[model samples]
Target: MAKTILVVDDSASLRQVVGIALRGAGYDVIEACDGQDALNKLTGQKVHLMISDVNMPNMDGISFVKAVKQRPAYRFTPIVMLTTESQESKKAEGQAAGAKAWVVKPFRPEQMLGVVQKLVLP
Candidate 1:
């Protein structure tokens, strides 16, 4: 089966960009505007991986990661946080919240695909 990825971001442009890249790499993509919506989507959908932004309206990436890890179904799901800068404190918080890795924006499709490939296939 094609791997499913849930992408959560407040920016429509960023979401579209990431969605297109994941789709081009042969993965199923699901979009959510914020962490709250992402959690709602997870109720009925199965996802192999998740890509989320650090800053959002409803809930931020760190909080989202914490929520995701709380669910047994999502405990092992790979998540990567997309951010504009590499903040050490934020990265640590994300890691503690159960994110497998972090990707600083502006995201490169090829580079992100490579990270996704390794995480999903490894």
Candidate 2:
């Protein structure tokens, strides 16, 4: 079965772009507008991986990562922070919160796919 991925970002266009790439690569996608929405989606099913943006309304990606780690069901689900922020401080903060990989914004589709492949085990 195709692995499912939860994509959390406030930009609808960005979600659609990433969703298209993921779907083309044979992964199922669940999209959420922000950290809160992503947390809400987590309860439904097994998400093999997560791609999130750092700056979002209600809750940001770092906080989201912390929250996800606290949940027993989704504790080990690998997360990739796909955001515009490239500061070491922000990356360290995300790393501390339990994110596995970090991908900066304006990324190529194949680059994103490669990161997904490495993290999402079949």
The model with the greatest lDDT is 2
Write down the RMSD of all candidates, one decimal each. 1.3, 0.7
Give TM per candidate. 0.95, 0.98
For residues 84-115, could you state the per-residue lDDT of candidate 1 as single tens digits?
84989989989989999899997689999998
* Residue ranges of candidate 1 with Cα displaced over 4 Å: none
Q: Which stretches in model 2 have alpha-carbon errors above 4 Å? A: none
* C-alpha lDDT values of all predictions: 0.90, 0.95
Best by TM-score: 2
Clashing pairs in 2: none
Model 2 per-residue lDDT tens digits across residues 7-112: 9999999999999999999999999999999998887588899999999999999999999999998898999999999999999999999999999999999999
